[model samples]
Target: MNLAAAHPGFLSPTGVEIVFVLVGVVTLAAAVITVTTRKLVHAALWLVVALGGIAVEYLLLTAEFIAWVQVLIYVGSVVVLLLFGLMLTRAPIGDSPDADSGNRPVALAVALASAATLVTVVVDAFRTYWIDLDASVQGSTAVTGESLFRHWVLPFEALSVLLLAALVGAIVLSRKDGPRAAGPGPVRDPDATGPAAPAAPDQPDTDTGPGSGTDAEGRR
Candidate 1:
């Protein structure tokens, strides 16, 4: 018996497949807009949509734990932190002319090459693999948690450290220097002669004989 005949073929997609395709389209559109939009804030918002769509796709794949984790970590924390950083840095709210570098063609070519490589790799790797969604929970909380902590714990902790360092670096970069501590008065030349003659004491006014007489009655 052919293994391919043991399951539903791709020609007749199930409801989950249909929903997944729809969500994937929306996610792709959002991602495209996120990259192509000239407004930074709009791009950030569109990224939220794209990320949320991915979380939805995860949910459709029956990975409930991973879906919630994606929502909380990426949609809730990461996107919110990104928007907060933008606000803190006082990023341009309107259309930013500097949003695009002068290397669009080069960037597009690189992006296309990277995308093609990734797609080819993923398709080649999973072309024959199939998941039985109805059989059992493939990614429950316990299973995912165990796998993560058991096998990927070191990398996970390292990523956390890297994120913390990035957050600190962002804070340091965004901070405005404190009004430079009032500069310790002006610097004095080490070779200056004497104590600068105490600024010459105010000279006492001398009376110009009888013609310079000033009376208390305001007559001079």
Candidate 2:
């Protein structure tokens, strides 16, 4: 028997599949705009869109818990943090001239290579795997909680620590020292045992007047 005949559902596309594909396209476009935009704030906003799109995709996949987590952590916290950091650091809100660096070509090449490698690896790994929507939910809160705590606890804790470090670093970098207060007079040491030094007397002024210079020359 042919493969399509053996698996009719695989050959036919469902409404969920269509929506998933559409959301994925939008998410990819938003991500591209996020990286390519000249305005830093706009890039951050686009990132919000991309991250929100991912949350929607998770919802469509019936992973409601994961979707909410994505929204809460990434969309709400991470994006807000990024915007705050940008504003705190006084980053250019308008179009930036130096947004594109001289090494962009090299960066682009590396990004493309990494993306290709990741795509290839993922496709190869999941070529035969398929989720059955009709079956029991796989991404429920209990299941996710168990998996996370049992298998992925270390990485999760590490990510939390990393985020905390980034927060602290941003605060440190953005903090500005206040100017020192000006004093009215010179500061003196209070521990000195000797008598206080007396102030110097003002010097008297001497003028070599014309008649005085002539009298002095005659005397010489």
Candidate 3:
């Protein structure tokens, strides 16, 4: 019944929208893997993929500065720091038995509740609002910077401090203790000449005393 004519952009999305949906799906899958993986390194790598997808979404939304910031901060710096922390803590390279504590059902329930809450909140907030693709809403660096520093300055600073604290906590947790004693080793006598050099292993009486030795021509 002419749905494209009735709803216009909603029914007939552009190529950007198609790409956005694809990216969003990929991001969601990566996020699920990030949370559910049994290996921490795999989870961190999946987190990078998810964050990279979000950055691509931002770029698709015409926010290049935010996209780059997302890539630089989350994907680059944060993931590298996370990998370093994992290395420093001697985390397992393969599947970590401690990663999943047999609480999958409970965790899944909590995750579903959180997702529902978030979806509800977002839907309620933006149900009646819509942005036109033809609008000239400039998402420039200056505007973004002003908005960040003016209205969200306190939260921004708080986030930075939070990240700093998290980094410090990671370092603290990954720091190793002093070397441990490897138990008592074989004790040697200081006055002994290294156990008499093992008595030369009893070389078959090769030199039959001083005169009984055989010459190079086999003559005694």
Candidate 4:
């Protein structure tokens, strides 16, 4: 009688399968939009959608811990940090045309090639594995995290160092008096404009008329 308990949105077997397909579709669409969106904030929103789709997939697979982690690490921390960076750096409020470049064709080609390679590898590797969806899934945040730290300690530390370095770099670069010697900065577009007026040669030694050059000329 109660459809909510019997065949909820995505908890039932059939619903899970259908939702997986939907999630895949939305995830792909979000990926495309994340890249193609002209606005920086819009791109960030699209990334959130993509991440949410990942969380949904994890949940459908009964990996609630991983799903929450997908939301926490990606949707929460990473996106928040990105938006913070955008805000702090005073990015243009209007559409950021250069947020991405004009190299869409190249980017798309690279993405397609990567996707094809991934598909081939996955298909070849899993051609014979029978995955039983009835299998019990463990969703332990602590265990997975411990395993990650234990196995990939070096890469984990490296990533932490990388993130710290990036934050420090952004702070240094955005400082009012950025990290640079107190010297004249490089010239911009020198050929685009007329040559700068030649610096005046060091003026010849000047004299204060009578007594100024007394030591030089022995004139008292």
lDDT winner? 1
Residue 119: error of model 3 in Å?
3.1
Shift of residue 155 alpha carbon in model 4, Å:
9.5
Better of 1 and 2 by TM-score: 1
RMSD for all candidates, in order, please: 17.9, 19.8, 17.9, 15.5
Query: How far out, in Å, is residue 40 in model 4?
Result: 1.1
Best by TM-score: 1
lDDT of 3 by residue, 113-136 (tens): 999999999976754544465576
Clashes of 4: 0
Q: Output the lDDT of residue 118, model 4.
A: 100
Off by over 4 Å in 3: 1-9, 117-121, 124-128, 146-220
Candidate 4 ranges with C-alpha deviation above 4 Å: 1-15, 141-220
By TM-score, how accurate is candidate 1? 0.66
TM-score, one value per model: 0.66, 0.64, 0.62, 0.59
- Give lDDT per model, in order: 0.76, 0.75, 0.72, 0.69
Per-residue accuracy of model 1 over 153-182 as CA lDDT, tens digit each: 999999999999997775454332213323
Distance from true location, Cα of 103 in model 3, Å: 2.4
Candidate 2: minimum summed lDDT over ten consecutive residues — where?
Answer: 198-207
